[model samples]
Target: MALSPCGNQSAVPTTFLLLGLPGLWETRLGLCALFLLLYLLTLVSNLLLLAVVWVDTHLHVPMYLLLCALATSETCLSLAVVPQMLVALASLHGTAILSYQGCKAQMLLSGGWACTNCFLLAAMGYDRAVAVSDPLRYTTRMGHHVCICLVVGCWLGGFIVAGGMCGAIFWMSYCPGQNPLNHFFCDIPPLLAAAQGVTAPSEAAVLLLSLLVLGGSVVAIVASYGSILVAVLKVHGGRSWHRAFATCGAHLTVVVLHFGCASFIYLRPKDRYTLERDCLLSITYAVVTPFLNPLVYSLRNREVHTALHKLLVQRRVEG
Candidate 1:
């Protein structure tokens, strides 16, 4: 409710201090530079993916629409976390400060966008399954209206879940004296670690809600891929087999990296959470994974490569 600097007074701290990777304090500036570079590249690549999808009418399909949404989520998630993280890394004390409201905003956006990506990935997996299993009806089943509804549902569901998570976490009394977050961002674990009056029911509620989002999405992805694998095996052509593997390979790679990093961070017991190790591992999901999505899809998806080439050639002719 009130703000005080770290050493300003012996009053309740209404602000949070983000302790950036303390183990690498001496190299904070270097880390900051590296993160900044990654953020820019992530933005450019994701934006290019969105633009390519938008301009290439040939890609105006359910799958590419889901990808466009994923790119958007990745961009927003990076924006929510990376800029403030850069500030923390560049701070003289290797820390950054955030007001209570600022911290909640960060938590909501980061959580919402991350959740959106998970759902979107599941939706994409289902799209691919339908494509492989029932190509003739793929267009009918995944029509434009259906895809739009799915995208809207994913965004709405993501923020709604995030809102509930944030509300539950922030409802408790924060430990005023223990206002320093061990991680660079106002993540759920760090915030819970610093909060007082955390009851078993409240913690269980939060954990259950998280598991519902993640666990449900994982089940959907597995089911979709299982169907895909069955259909691919039923087919008798190398071309079909090659297409299925290439497409699923890219999506599976991303799914593994994204879900693996998230599971490592959120699904573990509280006692196993070493702040230092967790903070280091969070960079993979928070930064590296977003940066890798465009690359993985571009390298693995032949249609994307052809679209990019066509766009480049069109630009050359126009220029």
Candidate 2:
């Protein structure tokens, strides 16, 4: 097969123009405005939650600690991919282009954030289950060391999975002139679509890795919560259900929203990939969900309010 010089030049200096939401030229500006609002809200809420959790020593328990880690991840989540999207959306010209290296960088960073989110959500489920099923030993079980280990494990796992996936996706062969990604960001579906020859292997590899990380995390979350449910039922009066539900309710909401959008984006085959649908899914998972996670926790979880109140009071007294 006589491969075109274009494929050979896939080396350095190769850039791809992102044709963001094609045929929606009139709507790009509106969408950009909406996303900008979302981006700002995500950053502010997550960062504030992080500050409260970090500074307030009262919030050093397992649940808050996990939340602190989540807020940090969400803060970085905006950094990983939203700016490029804003750039694409805001471009005066119809086309928005990114260098090959830049595109790969976006994908890697975003994937890392998403991976971290998955692991943290699962870990949180475990923490809640422990608090519900074994309140007496919850502190001892998820002690300082265990909490540190869990957070560290999430970071290491996210990095490894994201790095491997991004590396493989970018390293695959792309046919000549496949420069414009069908969607906004450099993502799996668009990347897979552009790749050349025997895509099954690459697709399988991506799917397996995704399932191993996301699917496995989801299973752990479900199992942990299921155990909590069982333990609640076994208790003398079933009084623990309220406490357990309160603890897991917000996290459960987040997990469902996160996994639902993520599964739609990641688990589907390439033939089923539709740009507009993928764009909406990405918005839900990548952009809106991060913001909503913090919002959900803050509104529904009373502990966060207490921690923030304590922090504010401390600040007032110090002043």
Candidate 3:
């Protein structure tokens, strides 16, 4: 199959094959069971985290609010990729083909949510910095209205970025090849690789948008964290300094992992699309990061632990 140029597109095949992981057959059952377990755990853990943050009045603070947002993002991020992956694992086709519209929709939502998480992490860092640097005015500065606006802005920015990327990608023409993507979901790099040599303008469009979203988010995150580091160091008390640093450690861990893997995949030029390496990096952000975020944040948070114990006690008393 050959893809025509962007403007001169002919009737190309509508379906595209999704090349499943290489050597997957040897451990299909194990991989399926492992992913199924991770998916289940991710849903349960994130939902529980959201519930704890939402129902507990003591947990109703900016930090918990950020946690709730992260939990929600984790749920959506897993949903964007895991279901399709599970279907492919359960089937012998070994390749999941998606329609053009389906591919576009998946890319839009996934990209949008991923970008939102990037901004959210940066916002969370800023929130922490404010709380640490000016503890007396933390509540007044990060008021409810301001927090709500920040969250809304993160989502809005994500939508704008996603829409632009989707527009660029779909505007490009596809070639008349088997249209096999070597990843579970419709990511930008794999999609671009599949449509390579089709058109120069379309390729350029995708590359530009990818760099813009990835580069812009990374720069914002770095700037936010740079200020956060300065704030942490300015605290006089040793205990205060330790606490401030601890508060940000989890967020920083996730930011680094998410941005690191994403930069590896999206920021590189088109010639660097190595299927195996890309697949590994995709799993880092797509699968591992979502699974790890709740564990890292909730497990380290004493407030969540206390709330969970109270919840369990209340439930037991009711029972």
My TM-score estimates for the predictions, one after another, are 0.93, 0.93, 0.91
The top-ranked prediction according to TM-score is 1
Candidate 1 runs further than 4 Å off: 1-13, 237-239
Ordered list by TM-score, greatest first:
1, 2, 3
Runs in model 2 deviating more than 4 A are: 1-13, 175-178, 236-238, 313-319
RMSD of each: 3.3, 2.3, 2.8
lDDT of 2 at 204: 80
Better of 2 and 3 by TM-score: 2
Model 1: colliding residue pairs:
none
lDDT of 1 by residue, 23-137 (tens): 8888889999999999999999999898889889999999889889999999999999999999999888989999988999999999999989889999999998998899999
Candidate 2 residue-wise lDDT, 238-305, digit = tens: 46777777878899899999999989899877899888888778877878988898999999977789
How much does candidate 3 score in TM-score? Answer: 0.91
Residue 48 displacement (Å), model 1: 0.7
Which stretches in model 3 have alpha-carbon errors above 4 Å? Answer: 1-12, 176-178, 196-200
lDDT of 3 by residue, 1-319 (tens): 3534444334665556777787676776677788889889999999989887777999888878977887888789889988887777777766677888888888888888888888788788778778767779999988888888888998898879889888878776565535778887888888877674454566677667777767776677677667766776776678866786677788877778888888788877677789877886886788788888898988778888999888889889999
Task: In angstroms, give how far residue 300 of model 2 lies from its true place.
Answer: 1.0
